[model samples]
Every structure is written in structure tokens, then in C-alpha cells.
Target chain A: MKHLTTKDLMTAGIFSALYFLAIGLVTFICMFTLPVLGNFLLPAVAALTTGSIYFLLLKQVPKFGAITIFSLVMGTFLLLSGHFPLAIIANLGFSGLADWFTYRTTFQTKHKSLLGYILFSYGLTGPLLPLWFMKQQYIDNLTSRGKTATYISGMFQYVTPTFFILLMFFILIGAILGGIYGQKLVAKHFGQTSSKQISDLYD
Target chain B: MINIQIKCLLLFITHIFLFIPFHPVQQTVLVGLLLSILFLEKERKRSLLYGSIYLVLLGILIALPYFKSFLGHSFGQLAMVFLLLYPCFLAGSLLIRTSLLSDWILLLKKCRLPMYLILPITVMFRFIPHFKEDFKHTFRLQKMRVPHSSLFKRLERTLIVLLHAAIQSSQELTMAALAKGINQLETRPVSKLTSLTFLDYLVATSSLGLIVWRSFL
Candidate 1:
């Protein structure tokens, strides 16, 4: 296994911030759009933004544990926020698994890398899974607040495991599309020149 | 204002207990923290105003569904989670804003963590400002497109260029830090300002007691 250089570590840190910025932007935009559709739309949009930026970032620094470290940091921040933090473990698990596949290619091939990214993106949806598992708590909170059964039912549609799984599937599809699109963006604009630049970044 | 170490401990236990159905204790901690923050009044005016707006919104959410059955379902559900998360979010913001990255680095070092782990985290803190500045240029790069290129091509090129500049800046930063001996753990001064006080112990004891009381399930 090739050890990551100091430069690799630094670049990974920068990309971590970059990924968060993109995700935060998407969250704000989706949050402000409309209520129900916004909640449904958030995952798909987040998958695209984070996935593409992550691919571009991975291209810049092709190392083994980059995904692991980045996901861990993001997860830590999530945990600190007192939200559904178990997703951090989910992220670490999936990203570590993806890193295994990427190591098979030694972070060389784009298709294999994209495959890893798609698997890795599943972790982003992990935080939202509480809506399914914590259904009773969520419903109780709403019901206590005088939310009607019909209103609760509307909310329930979005919280169902079936619906959550569907959203995850949609996110998976977006990540796949975004990964392919990111590669194309690279090939079209920067191409071989950036590969040399990427190598230079390692120094 | 709490010290960093206790704040960390408070954050940890609070985060853990917050999820495990400790309504009475949780609400007290959350409301206390929220009010203290609001009273501090740095962003107090906004907090006050937003507080009213949020309450009104919550009321609207609870009431709106009774009248318009079709519209309230998903929105009410979403609002419930939002309200539940709001206080915790405020507490988190307070902890994060109060705690510096260097403070975390020192705490990690005191815990006998490695240089490799510490370096990346510190550099992550360092990079936030640069990323914020460069993020603005991404839009500018989009507007300053190639004359003959189509819109899609210009957009693609902008992403490539923006990332290129970012990666380059990171490389430069690493080199600068490296030259300054950032890789040497001995060189960076870890603050000895903190020792676990009574509050830290109290926080730990409370969390452990709570966990045991809940039967550790």
C-alpha cells in the first residue's frame, strides 16, 4: 500500500471542506424551494453536488483512505450537531468498503473509482434513515403537537422505509449520473493536462 | 461560558441522551442552553425574532392540517422533525462556535493522538477561509467564458478551472506548512490550559447514570 504524502492529506482536507460547502448549498436551496417536494428533492440534489465534487476531488488526490477520512470528518460534524449521527458509522463503513475497491485499482481507473463513489454516496442518505426507524418518536412528537391523523399520514408517506429506500435508490442513480458527468467534464475541459497537474499536487 | 473540555463532554452525553428518549432531562438541558444563548444576545435579536417566527410556524403547522387535510401531511411531519432538531442545533452551534479548531487539536494531542490525524484536522480548519474566498471565483469563472465556446462547454470549463485553482492552492498551502515544519509534532504548541474540572466529571457521571438508569438497553 502506498502511503499518503503530506500534500495528499492537505488536499483531502480541502476537498472535505469543498464537499461540505456543496452539500450545505444544496440543502439550503432545497429547503427554501417548497416543503414536501423540498424534503424529497434534497437527497437527489445532494447526491449530485457531493458526488461530482468528490469525484473531481478524488481525481486530484488518488489515495486509499481519502474517502474514509473525509467521510469521518463529515460524520463527526453531523454527530456533533445532535442529529442522526449513527449515519457517521454508516458512512465510515461504506466508505471503507469503497476504499477497498478503489485500492484494487490503486486509485487508477476512473470507472472503478466511479463505482467506488456510487457505493460511497449511499452513506450520505444514511442520516435520513432515522425517519424510518424513529417513526414512533416522530409521530408521537407530531401527534402531541396536535397534528391530525391525516396530517400525520401525509408525513408518514415521506418517512416510510419504502419511501426512504426509494429516495436512496434515486440518490444512487444521481451519483452514477453525476460521476459519469464529472468524468466527462474533466475530459472535455482539462483532460490530460490536469492528470499532470494532479501528479504535481502530490508534491 | 463553559470550557472546551466540558463543552465537549456535555455535547457528547447530550447528543447520546438526546436520541435515547430522555425527554425531561433532555428538554431541560436544551432549553437552558437555548435561553442562555439567546440572552447572550450576540445574535440575540435574530434569535428572539426567529423564535417567534418558529413558534408561529409550529402553531400554523399544527393548525393548518386540521383545515386543509390534503396539504398538511408531509409538511407537518417535516415541521415536527424541524422543531425537535431546532434546540439541539442551537446547542451544537454554540459548542462549535465557542470551540476553536486549535483547541480540538490540543485536546487530541493531550489524549496522545498521532500527528497524522491532528495535521489533517487542523489543516481542514485552516482551509475553510480559503474555500470560502475561492467559492466566489467559481461563479466569476463561469461568467468569464471562452468567446467561441457554447454555454455547456463554458460551464464545464469553469468547473475544471475552479477545481484546478483550488487544488493548486492546497498544494501551495501544504508546501508552506511543511517548510515551516508543520509536520513536526514538537513544533506546534499544544495548550496546557485545560484539565478536567468538576463539571467534566459531573457531565460524565450524569451520562453514565442516565445510561444505567435506562437499563443500558
Candidate 2:
């Protein structure tokens, strides 16, 4: 319900651009690395961490404009970085949903609990669901190609499970880190300075 | 003056041509011709320079996959990279040149999309460029202050500034939208909206025709 000042609007714009640049950089790095770990790590962990940092800063800045900024930058970055068009669309859609959810959770609850909002934001990573599905399809395609048993067995043993596990790990890690950062931000900005507040940061 | 209809149709034809699986040489030639037509309209010298620069960049971009193969990469890997990157770049360029954000918004409105959804999208489009500029300015300021930070630190600082900005702006944007009478519940008749021109029809028809031809012929 709070109106953003001119300064706040300016800040939102800046963050959005940074968000785009960061995503592009991370994705570019992953492309060069082309490692299974790099693929999941860069897109999931890097992106979510950046989002969390945005939320943490937003607590003090108190601007909803950041949501739009994040969405635009991420969408543009994905588009320009040669990701699938659907991925770009998903990024925008999910970011918007995450923004709305964060806003509702913070304002409606009247507590501005960072943990709640962080969890809400993390849930919006549902866009990555398609990646997992795609991986399964790739495995199936390989199997259908009559690839050697050793290759199939090696992929099933190493590639498939490693990807899913890494993805899940990064998602959870990103969420937990974001939640912690959010709590720290709330405590610092909202002046809930207590030992309990510090301890409750992860909650 | 080029008829807007013709221009729109040309745009559609170009898009369709770009997507077809033409031979590599044919694709390059088509791309060159299209780029020339698109960029070399008014100032011959400037367009020539632009076209040359574009070709150089595009050559590098396209050759990157093959370059990797030359450096001991497999054909399949190189082909995969090309497949993933080329369409995305083409699609992005097309979207930037041909698609208007406002037009998309109008279409959404016509489809009776909820304001909550439409408003955020509109605001985001409006905000992204502004945010990018602001972040650059902030980064400059931060650089002036630190002047010697590591690259990682500099990046962190930049991100921090951006996050701060986003939190500060949304409320003002939302209020500005509300002030413009955007949130009103009154519904207007969709039939009263502006009609599509002949160009729109021509472009639509040609695009569909090209798509069918490319897909089935």
C-alpha cells in the first residue's frame, strides 16, 4: 500500500537491468563450461541468489517497481542469451507471480515476514520443471537410438540422477539462503533488533 | 512512401524466409539480402558500414560452433549449439524490430485479460530500460568511490544497487498507473476499438502462407 518515491523507482529500474546482465553472464558462463554441474548451478543457484538479493534490498527500499524491473531484465536476458523463447516467457510469468505472491504475503499478513516471502518466491521456480522433463526426454531419446548399453547405463547412473539431485539441491539451497538474507534485511531495516530476531532469521 | 501494408507484408515474408531450412549458402545469401534491405534504406554509406559490421559479427557468431569443431569438437555438439543459438538470436532480433509492446498490450486487452496481469507486464516493459540506465549510473558512482574493488565485488555492489532501486520504484509506478484511471472497472465495447489496416491483413495472410509452404511444400 506504500507509494514509491522517485528515488525508489530509479532504484527498481537499476536492479532490473542488473538482473538481466547477471542472468546473461551466468548463462554465458554455463554455455562455455557445458558441464552438467555448471548448467544447473548457473541457472538455478545464480538466478535465485540474485533474486534473493533483490528482495533483501527491497525490504529497505520498499518498492514494488523492482518486480517489473526484475521480470523485464530476466526476460530480455533470456531472450538475448539464446535460451528457448518459452524459457524467457516462463521467467517473466514466474517472476510476476512471485512478485504478486511476495506482495500479498507481506502486506496481507501485516508482519512482513521475510521467511514467508522468500518461500513464496522460491515456489515460483516451477518454470524449471520443464528442464527436468526435458532431461527425461533426452534420456529416452538416447535409449531409443540404440546407444550402447555402457553408454545408456553410464548416463542413467551418472547423468540423469546427478542433474535432478543438483537441481533440487540448488533450489533448496537458494531458497534457504534467500530466506536468511531476507530475515537479516528485515531485522536491519525494520529495526527488530534482538537476539531472537537474529536466531529466527532462517525461520 | 512505402505502403504500410506492403511493409508489413515484407516483414512477414522476411520472418518466414529466415526460419526455413535453406541450404547454408542460400541461408547466408538470404540473410545478407534481408539485412541489407532492413538496414540500408536511407543512408547508403552508413547502411554499408552497418551491414558490414553486422555481417562480421554474424559470421563470428555462426562460425563459433564450427570453430569449436575445428578445435576437436564433434559435429553433433557443434550442430546442437547452432540449433539452440541461431533460432533464439533470430527470434529476438525479429521481436525487437517487428513487435511493438503496446500492440501486444492492446491485444491482451482485447482478449479481456485481467488488469492485474496486464498492468505488471506493461510496467515491466516500461521499467526495464530505465532500470538499466540507472544501474549504469549507479555503477559509475560506485566505481568512483571504490575505484579499486575486485570484479566480483564490483558486480555485487551493482546488484545491491539494483535491488535497492526495484524496492523503491514499484509503489510510485503503481500509483501513477492508478492516477491515469487505469484501475477503473468500466468496460468499453471491444468493437469500438481501432480496426486493423489492410497491411495487417496482408502481413497476416503472407505469414500464414509462408508458414504453410515452408512446413508442407
* Interface RMSD per candidate: 3.2, 8.8
CAPRI quality level assigned to candidate 2 from its DockQ score = incorrect
For model 1, the stretches where C-alpha displacement exceeds 4 angstroms are: A105-108, A140-158, A195-203, B22-29, B38-57, B64-70, B110-116, B140-158, B186-188, B195-217
* Cα shift from native, residue B130, model 2 (Å): 1.2
DockQ of predictions, in order shown: 0.49, 0.17
| Model 2: reference contacts kept, as a fraction | 0.17
What is the clash count for each candidate, in the order shown?
Answer: 1, 16
Judged by DockQ cut-offs, the docking class of candidate 1 is acceptable
| Model 1 lDDT per residue over B1-217, tens place | 3566656565565565546554434444454555455445365765666467567655856465464453565566566666666655655665666667767676667657556556666776676666666766765666665466675565455555557766776778788978987777656665466766675576557645655765542
* Model 2 regions lying over 4 Å from their true place: A1-22, A25-40, A51-132, A135-159, A189-203, B1-85, B97-101, B185-203, B214-217
